[model samples]
Target chain A: MIEGRYFYPHATRFVAARASAASGMLRVEALDGSLLNEAPAKSLRLSPALGRLPARLSLGDGSHFESDDRAGIESLRRELKLRAPGGLLHRIERSWRGITLAVLATAALSYGFVAFGVPFIARKLAEATPPSIAVAMSRQTMQILDGRALAPSALKPKDRARLEALFRKVSAHEPRGAGGYTLLMRRGPGVGANAFALPDGSVVVTDALYALAKNDEEIEGVLAHEMSHVNHAHGLQRVYQASMIPAAIALLTGDVSQVSQMATVLPGILVQSAYSRNFEQQADDDAAAILRAMGAKPSRLGDLLLRLEEVHCHKGGCAPSWLGSHPETAARVERLRQETGK
Target chain B: MSGEHEAAVESGAARSYPFQFEGTGGEYFGIWIVNLALTVVTLGIYSAWATVRTRRYFRGNMVLAGHAFDYHASPVRILIGRAIAFVLLLGYNISLNFSPYALLVWIPAFLIAVPWLIVSSLRFNARNTSYRNVRFNFTGTLGGAAKAYIFWPLIAMLSGGFLMPLARRVRDYYHINNHSFGGRPFETEFTGWQIYSRFLIAFAMWIALMVAFFTFIAVSAKFMPHGKAVSPNDIAIMAPLILMIAFLEIGFIVVGIATMAMIYNLALGHTVLDGRHRLRCRLNPLVLAWVVITNTLLTLATLGLFYPWAQVRYTRYFLGRMALEATSDLDEFTSEAFGTQSAVGEEIAGFFDLGIGL
Candidate 1:
């Protein structure tokens, strides 16, 4: 007789069970001086055992028998020789060696996923995204930032028009059919001396950046860098990669329609330039190529970087929080100067 | 002495039904590690099952009066509930980005749903739990729960947290009055003013701590090495700053632990179960603080492998202090064999990471 509790659909009854090996019939009786219905042993489905946790045997007729008596259950299993498969999970739980292997495998897989798998998937997905969606998102972001950190350009109209004309001339030199590229001038002390590209083919040049640049070529170098970011959809890729872990979590938990929070978080990550070191290097190389194609000096961007660093680093040697994720300025300048033969 | 003392002494001479925890750290460690590994390998898809396995292990090992408790929550139900909760949370987060007005609407909407979630979580947990052929039950109403968990807390917060003890009283009363084992309600007579008086002692300790912190800061500033703009690079000035910072961190930790211990001891000492069964939990703040600090340090040093050991050590220490007195036989209680509870609310609360066991 097996010692277990028989949980009826509406009540719990502690019961004794007897299994007939020949006819494959199982009989259950309540231990509290009562009787229970007999059922075929074939109807019972056994759940996998984990350590001392009781295995649940479902009779599939609105009744369940749970027992911690491993010896009795094992003997019954042998007598019946029924095919009660535990799958991969049970195999791992059954022994210490399997558990160790599982742990090692899990650690390795998680590392690989985080380090390589997520970024790879992000890149592929970003590449597949329509350019129109990125453009619309970019417009929305600029509208949000306009009243917050930015204002109408304080630079003279001629100066603004000249830079806009220069940007159009450089962008038109090579048309990849990305879209019509536009130049936006903003007086943004909050963003002080920063230039960033929007996926909607808009290159924003802050007035602070113009004041820092020594000449038109230096400003052109910054514009080239921003343009490359837009050209490669780097902003979109960064957003996708930053949201990967949460997206994976949502997918695993069967939360398919929860894209709203991701939308909210995406803008911040994009503005912060949460790109991997590889993405940064790729954008820098592309910027250099674009500068060369424009017949402009590539080393001016490097010189501008050094000038900006000297001005900003004097205050306790701290970079502004906006530039926190950028590659080290010193190393980047050195590499760019090498490419420029300066 | 008193009538209660006499009855307690008489019962003490009879069978003392001491709650026993038969789980060992080493045995639990194997299960915990395995569950973590499986959950990660499955990319968190197996967490529903893992939760069940973990609860089962803990409940199965807790023995009271020669019978162990049982947890029979279906993983499928939990999975469905989790999915719904995740979607709602995601939607809420997304709505915040849609517009400022959306955020204004979302916060209150979620708050309004809290009372319902609390009720569902309680009912789900109670229905799933059974001991010796009897199931536990909760019959708390929505309005009562809302008053306890939300409105009272809001009033307390609006009053600079001074009325928190009153809120605690309301919450405890709601919880204890509604809780039942085998259709018999547990009675509590502990008053709100008693809780407030106890909390005042803790409030005084906080004031003392603040005074001490400011005094230490003043003393440190006075004793700081006077020189021509002594930089942090100077070893003479740096040494004292490092020592002072470490000392302040330790003091903060102690104050935090002491406050928690005081509140815990006060609550446990006042709680009564089944009218006849009274609980007395005597915990020393200093000892508890030391245990917690040491446990954290050890767990970190072992790279989190010592988690199960730390958990078991803490549980044993906390539960060991609790002494329950029963005036009558425990076997006489019988739960009603009707009513089915849905696991949706429990799953939703768990998924959204809300406080439920409170």
Candidate 2:
């Protein structure tokens, strides 16, 4: 008769088996009290004794089996070691499930925001823009406002020739007026040094801005930038947004009275209607590309930006009029410098 | 020795089985179901408790040479460890977002955080187990944890593109060099580079098969006589859909078989120096086939209600069939105490009445 321990680490199970050999007949009983009748000449055969336990065997008369009462099963376990099995999927399954759930939850939450958030912000911005800034005027109305005679007066031949050349050069780019953009450069009294693009893409530059330019490159750089605002349809987008505000408010409240209430805050809205930093950067890049295509040194824009910043800094509290409707001079200067690689 | 034999003869003593078997196969399913239910109800708070319960069951029921294995973990300690990990993760995220130079702060933070987590896990595992007047202690190295984190993710990404052979390499890598209590380390002589090439070949073959499948569908659709307004556009859309479904079905089968193969490879890698402690698992193609078929049918039939049950059955069958061999000194006996406490266990027990005498 022989007795020994059998360890199975993966299942975390341990078993003890007893065998008896006599008269060339051997009978082996498993730890769970099940009997095994078959014993091959040099092998041990197991039976399905324990519920889920599989059978095992040993060869060569089982001479390696030992019997000890003092040591107990624990000591036997120490002598024969077993390793626990590890699974790759089992380890990472929880993490994968967690990430997947989080992504789904985030998507569910963000769906509501996308459905309502963007339009709401756009409506608020539109309510802020002034109607006077948004609406366009007829060419006849503009001529009447300028007090021009019904019959135009003849101009001096040299002055007329110069005026025609200027008009030809300006119109060659074919600046579209779908958004009611109109360029007006004039030498007017009390109109300080300035050049600005209105929400309607109407670029109004004073004669002082032409005098401030060191050469035609700087003048052309400013012209190209204003043209980009028109070409890119930024003005039309603004007007459409300005019109959408009251409509959205009406949709939300089902009342038209709020539109008048919103009109009182229009000036404050226009004061804050500056383009986003990304938009300004895009305009600067476009201007640099256009000026370069027109055979001009794009850095001339950088020089103008530096002069504007210096003037704004010297004024301390007050900025140059051109600095309005845009970022601070320092910021614009840095952007232009980056664009022109200066 | 002769005297001992004579004593045995004189006393008429008979040899007894070395292990104590008190396990009931079906009881574990009940526990698994219950644990799963509790986890679902508690919204994952039961995870820590479940871990403790699982460790206790597996340890308490294991019978070796008439002695039972035992393990106990402090839930409070585990909870505290998790809390610390959460705080560390938050700090790491903050640093990543706010630091001017992330390279200076974020990388070190991650390195420290990962090692801390690994150490905590090992400590928890060690403090949970008790055996024969000696409590188990964890002695994991930080270097190992770092290596595991760095290489495991890379392996996951690489295997996604080259699944078949890379899967084998990953299995072998995990099994190799795994050390146990009896000074037995796992062995795998295969290299990853060799498996990578084989995976590339397999991937190419799979792509070719996919192309052929699409071509067959296209050719068949083109040859069919038009009864109605059959346009090439219609064929184009229908062909892709049919090919997609066929591809998914075949992919599931391949993945299922590959999973089994990886398991078998892992088992083969585990071996003790004395040759007694060993494990050998054979990939049962029929078992994998049944899993794929049953899962597909269940998805079609119960609309996923039977998913949990299918999962439990699959796990039970695979685990039950696993075979282990050890030296004569160590005994093998299972007890109901080791059964997991989760909802899946109950469902399994209800489906298959193994009556694991709990």
Candidate 3:
């Protein structure tokens, strides 16, 4: 038997309701003992139980009974053989053992997703993005950078043309044979000694970087690295990866308010950094392969990288931007030496 | 037994009823952890369902005048709304990828849409919440929302923030005045100037903190030796003092507690439901700040596993102090079926990091 308060939809009052196996029905009685409702046991629906809150059982006529009598609810269910499919969720929610197992499972799954799943998915998505979208993204970035931090090339006309020819030679030897690749020579005093690839296959070689290289082969090495970044769509992948941060944060906090502020700030930070250590290594490996195809020693790029690091690392502390965002130069040079059989 | 209680309430016998929240930290903690586990297990696909279940638990646990409040949103509806919001977000990202100039158009367009979005969100939420099975309703106009959300904030900004109190008043009035339960409107009688009077305490606290900070700096400069070179003894003596000053500076921000508490107290104190029911909020700023700071520390220490406890403790502290003075019998209010509302604008506003007006 079960007893609880019943609320009819049309009235703002409570009626007494009772159900019994002997009667094989549920009935509601008004305050003055008049019959308010009577329905067969099969005509009622039960809301899923959540915590210690009252359980609500609704009849066909829109009136519902709310009760916290756990024993009575269980008995009623057993009498009717009500096979609640949500028994699994209810069991897991009610027991300490199930909750402990869930917590551990969730922890392991989240760690795996963050450590391995997200990067792999980002890489695949980047690879699948249309080349035209990548190119447009790169062009827009270059225009914005030019307006802010870049100027016309400060090197002599002959020097600029010579490097341009070297860029053309490298592009020709590519598997796609100069597939929409453009090389721009520009002075970037603020971003000293840097080479970067835009998503659209445009590589910018700063005057400071060109001057920093000891020989044409060294400059060729840097060009090869930049080309690899463009070909692999690293920039686009980085942006896409940043877009997932809020989702990850939401999972961690389980609160909507906590992840809201990250939507605006996370994208800016991701775009400024080149990418992860794995991305940097891939670019380096590609640069070495390109140098080998050209019959030039791949060690030249490593030598240039070491020199650049030494120049930037004045007084034993490297620039914050250099050491923080990018991988260690010493490690990359060591890897390059191994590839070159040095 | 139920009939006798109903009669006592109808005889114009007044009572000072304290709102009740029966949710315990341990009970809610289980629900919270389970919700989180399932949300992660489903790769966020089940978050909409999780949201509904969480809302239902909290609302169902709250009892007023012998009846519990209820939330009637469907998980499928919320999922569809969230999907729409995510698609819009992707479109915004694509625009950013296309060109920086898209920002020129996007910012203004986003601002213009804020009022309409606020209205939609309020309508969606109010239409879904029910007490005694009668759905609450909101009828504020988009134009009124625009004036409250945009124009007043702009005027406040233009006036060097002196008119911020007025902006808050405008927003509060818009929220309270438009709310109704079964066709009876909520009435708020407080004015902008009244809010400003309460705001003066916060403003004064800010000025005093600034003066004290500068004074401390001046005193330190007078006593300390010049130049960057300092002895180890000097460093040891100054470090603790500097740390203490930093702590004091953070403590000064507790004025935020004062400001927020005063706003809620004043606003709710003047708001009348059905022109008969009265609300009283008696929150103490120091106590509130203590709860906030300790809860934050505890949640951080446990790496957010303790969040459910912290949330429950905070809610119970705040709601426990609130009371409703019943002038008429609450049992007389009958339930009327209302049309369903889509959760799209609520989810979209949530995506944009805007608070849902309560």
Which candidate number has the best lDDT? 3
Query: Candidate 2 or 3, higher lDDT?
Result: 3
Query: What DockQ values do the models have?
Result: 0.22, 0.03, 0.27
Best by DockQ: 3
| Model 1 DockQ class | incorrect
Two-chain complex of model 1, DockQ on C-alpha atoms against the true structure: 0.22
- Give lDDT per model, in order: 0.66, 0.46, 0.73
How do the residues A169-273 of candidate 2 rate in per-residue lDDT, one tens digit apiece? 433543552334556555434343455555445565655565566766776677667666655545434444344333332222221221223332442243234
TM-score of chain A of each: 0.75, 0.43, 0.79
Candidate 1 clashes between residue pairs 3 or more apart in a chain or in different chains: A260-B94, A261-B94, B182-B335
Residue B299 CA displacement from its true place in model 3, Å: 4.6
Stretches of candidate 2 above 4 Å error?
Answer: A1-342, B1-43, B55-71, B81-112, B115-123, B126-139, B151-178, B182-212, B217-243, B249-253, B256-260, B263-267, B273-276, B289-311, B331-358
The positional error of residue B168 in candidate 1, measured at the CA in angstroms, is 4.0
- Across B1-358, the per-residue lDDT of candidate 2 in tens digits comes to 7587446535634332233334443444333334444443453345455555545555555554445556646545544554454344444433332222545766767776665565456545643454432234444456655656545555666776444455455434443444223222334445666556545544555576678667867887676667865543454655766677777667645644555444454435343323334454554655655665665466346532343355445444554444444433332212221222121121111111111100
Error of 1 at B213 (Å): 4.3
The DockQ value obtained for model 3 is 0.27
Question: Residue B50 of candidate 3: its Cα lDDT?
Answer: 77
